[model samples]
Target: MDAAPLAARVTRIATLVAGLPALPPDDGSRYSPRRLTVSWLLEAESVHTEIAHARDLGAFLDWCNRERLDPLTARPTDLAQFKVWRGAGTGGTPAAASTVARALASISSWYTHLVANTDGGVTRNPVAAVKRPPVNRHTSTTAGLTLDEVDALLAAADAQAGARAAAAGRTPTGQARYLAALRDRALLRLLADLGLRISEALDRDLGDLSNNAGHRTLRFVGKGGVHRERPLTPHSLQALDEYLAARAAAAGTTADRLSGPIFATTGAGGDGRLAEPNIFMTLRRLARIAGIASADRLSPHSLRHAFATGAREAGIALEDVQDAMGHADPRTTRRYDRDRHNLDRDPAFVLGARRASRRSGNQR
Candidate 1:
């Protein structure tokens, strides 16, 4: 197969995908007017998906070039071959169903858009005929803590702060860690109650906490650099108040140290906002102190999962959960709702299974 023709087509597709006007078709050969239209339509529709769509689309085009098949003449077998190649195991890890699905869907959409605009370049989407690989949403391991565990962790943080207060030393090292523990207690509460991502929580400044009309709120930029202001829960407010007061006192009576980041560096080194790694290491140490099972299994995200899960079980609205978590899509929130993941919740287990009158029941 000639790589030059394929490279030209890929280049045209790339140019359009980058939201640039297409270069004038080269002197050699040109794609149909309908194909160009389809490319732009796919581009317009894929803005929300961004680079992931571009990547999947590029892979499919490369595969089509390797097979020497145009969309106009591409058969169902060609689509199947692409799927097999993409879904093959990497090292020992199997390619995720979600990954395979994305690739197939991108190719399928391209063909679909072309078919919609074309007279006869393509008759049908080959992907439409093939069964989509199943993505089991329940298989995710986004774990949450039970309320008792949550209580224990928070209590452990408070206990550590108290212990550190009593263990005051002349050296700044001990006091720095002590202040850090106080910060960690507050951080844990924010994550467990407010449902903040670690980055969102850490990126907050001192001024982000404000009150309006008797309601306290915390402001931060979420994913996609979208700023969000959520009213503080009572529990979270109380924790924040205690933490902030402790933080202020820990940094001395001066107001300068309190001017910036809500979570400043402590524990003997580093400054100007606590990094995510510091937060993680702090949580790990706190988790061990709290007697939680494994270091690797527990994370700040677990607290977030706990927040969402606990809210769901307490009957908070799903949209409320989405907004509070700063999820871009409600479907993403639904995925985080672990309520349906439990095997015991299935209808296969009836609460009371009657023997159905042993005399009348016939054995299979």
Candidate 2:
């Protein structure tokens, strides 16, 4: 629990992780040491939401290597067959269409990486042509918690806090209460209010929050390496300020330097102490406690969806929602427009049709 030795270990881990290069300068035809280092980092971070799914990603990569299905040379048929192979019962049940689609997306991104790093003449992305099962474009309502559900989740967290304090043989009436209720309430509110991807929130640095001339904005690095700024609401800002204060006190530090992680592990680093717990882990725990879904529905991405749905209901302009969601294509933004679903249920459609038929019968 000593600060000096704890800081030293943190420094050592950072040194090792920081030594990794972002990407290879040249193509993989000529493997450089720097390329190897970058490769190692990519593989290490490949431990995604599911290790089993990540293994499938590796298998797909291996398939590409064996088939020599380079984007530069492979035909559409070849790509289609590869997709079929992925879903076929080669050993077990066929892979889900959604899973196959996800793998294809990852492969498409990998191809984009290749094109960016080397030649830019990979004319076609075959994955674009592959016909898969129709995907329901509707965002799932099952995952996101309504306002009432959020209240229930918050209550559950408070109850857990009480149990913890009781077990510690102390009155549940001091820092313990603040740590449990305030810290986690702020975290959940940030997710719901901002619609921040868990990773985006986790990746937040102190400098990401800025106030200038009485306006507050939270800067975030979004997907596809895009940087975005979202105006912070008064409630969000207040919660953020309180969380920051509590965080500083917990660390036993006073300097509010706009550097270092916005969030970090409590206490000293050890075998159990996380220098930085993965944001996804925080989401999973929260979901488990809140009883959100039987399957995994608690992640940064789910929160992002919840934000989009909330905005749609609030009658925010589609363009504004698109910008908030950090969507590249307007068509992708169009998908989030829940207006169409409501329009589909209009009485005009059924009533107008019946009236027209009745008028036609009279005319006959």
Candidate 3:
């Protein structure tokens, strides 16, 4: 947690808040945008938000340092080089376009913020100066699990949970691991069925899920603190029930059984809310255990993608898919619609039996 070199520059910038010597239009662009990005984001209350912003900022800084480039003097050519470096191989495998797109967006937003807040003193976004890598949102091959794969994952989770429960002993460590297995099963099933973001899945209290007349639903705050409710699928509800039973057994006595996170940490933290990174680790491990082909790409978001895609394939309307996935924009949901984009499974080919029959009759 030691302060970065930019820390000193930011401290100096704070001093110049009131009456600073203004930069001349052409030649006075000497302050590093790298320093400005770190300071600006950290100062704008973004430190408490998504950590990806800081990660992207740090990566950009590292890229600049390695290239012997000054952020203040970076041009369109430098931006293009960064894009190439970001998209191409580390070990003969290219990075995902989505990842490069996010990093570019972070850098672009940093420059835009500087331009706006600094009275256009920093006039240009270097990212805007170059062509960004094309993100093929409509073409996501490894974007999600198939429905059978999702079911297989859930089955694997259940089998593992049963095994752990059977082997669990009186020892604290053994009990915690057993409980963690149970929790992971429920968590994975929830995400797989509900199409929830990791943040939404993790940010839940015990009371968030409620049952009425044998129908169950979850009410929780989503992005932008928007409160939303989604009906629970039967499999998700059953998995949840099993999880709660296991949770009670894991709670022992000292742990509160009724309040706090629905998916609490059963590992070293013991009843503390499980963090997002751990959720990711759990999903990855589960995906590997389930023998998923694209285990590396299987994340909580991937499960969400699976849910949306599977729903679309089942003949659900586009708007319904959007509503179920809690997407404010249909366009966002469209990206998750792998079935819609899958030309090989086109209805024109699959459902053209009458045309085939007519051709056969004419030939006869």
Candidate 4:
């Protein structure tokens, strides 16, 4: 095979992977092992997952190119070296254990697909013989907001919306700003209230909101393409209603007539769906206005962390919280709870409380 630029190879691989299903059925004669392997491996994955896998694999392919090694025929020793290089940071800063683990997982999945689909063309997965970094499942490194911080963030968003609303009728610019502020307020409320993944929240359409058993609920396609519904809290519903009303007013229509993205750009020609970066920037700006100490590091996920931690601290059962967060594994939910290992909530404290109560009863 001819040596190709890394970017070109990645682009070609992505195109091939996306087009695989449309190709007519044929024997192994048509495609290269690499193309067939990537296509089959990522066929069932969502677009987001496919892109991530491609990126991770692309990094490894780039490394192989630099090392004068063929990725398809790479040995265990080659993978071991690649792992060390990746962990040590292709840049100056070392990658996190979880990141390295994910990269290795992507590579391993690729080789596994090749071995399974190619008969005896590939003997084994080289990544199988390589040791992977241990990922800590009990905790995450993403910063979490406290209940007070969550309140402050909401207040900040509300204040901005209020200010913008006052000027909305004056000019077109004012109306646009007011609309955007309303959207931001509602988006923040939903994130804090529901702990939705940013992607899940952004993917919402106005039509997704419906009455389920007389309760207002949001239907979203969550991780793994699972359809899930979460009942909206009164506060979340109110925020959403206000935003929708404002959006409809801006469009010279009623709230009932509005449809499409729940959070959309204010631009006239832009797609209605709000991008993830927009939410990220919005959160950081609100965090700064809220005087949060971690304002610089604040992200939309911080509100999700706040939801999980606040719910757990308020004595919500782990299983219930896990269900609300749409986590398949309780451990993943636990990772979002900042106080999962808090000493103050230890079983010893519960035991001590019971002992004290028993002593009082005995004296009585």
lDDT winner: 4
lDDT of 2 by residue, 116-226 (tens): 554544445666676765555544433555555555555665565455444332433355445444445556667777777666665566677876557888887776667
Candidate 4 C-alpha error for residue 312, in Å: 1.4
Question: TM-score for model 4?
Answer: 0.83
- The reply for model 4, stretches above 4 Å from the true place, is 1-48, 117-123, 166-173, 360-364
In model 2, which range of ten residues has the least summed lDDT?
267-276
Q: Candidate 2, after superposition: displacement of residue 96 in Å?
A: 3.6
lDDT tens readout by residue for model 1, 115-153: 766567568888988777998754455555677788888
Residues 293-318, candidate 3: write the lDDT tens digits.
Answer: 88776767888888888988888898
The TM-score that candidate 2 achieves is 0.63
The TM-score values for the models, in the order shown, are: 0.58, 0.63, 0.73, 0.83
- lDDT comparing candidate 3 with the true structure: 0.73
Q: Which of candidates 1 and 3 is the stronger one according to TM-score? A: 3
Ranking by TM-score: 4, 3, 2, 1
Minimum summed lDDT over a 10-residue window in model 3 is located at 18-27
Clashes of 1: 0
lDDT of 4 by residue, 1-364 (tens): 1234335545756565544332223454645564675565446334455656867877887787688787767899999999899999856899999889999998898888878777777778999999889988887889889899999999999999998888999998888889899889998999999999888888677788888998999998888878999999999888889988878877888989876678888889322778787888888898999999998898888889999999999999999999999899998998899987899989999999999999999999
Instruction: Please give the distance, in angstroms, between residue 325's alpha carbon in candidate 1 and its true position after superposition.
Output: 1.4
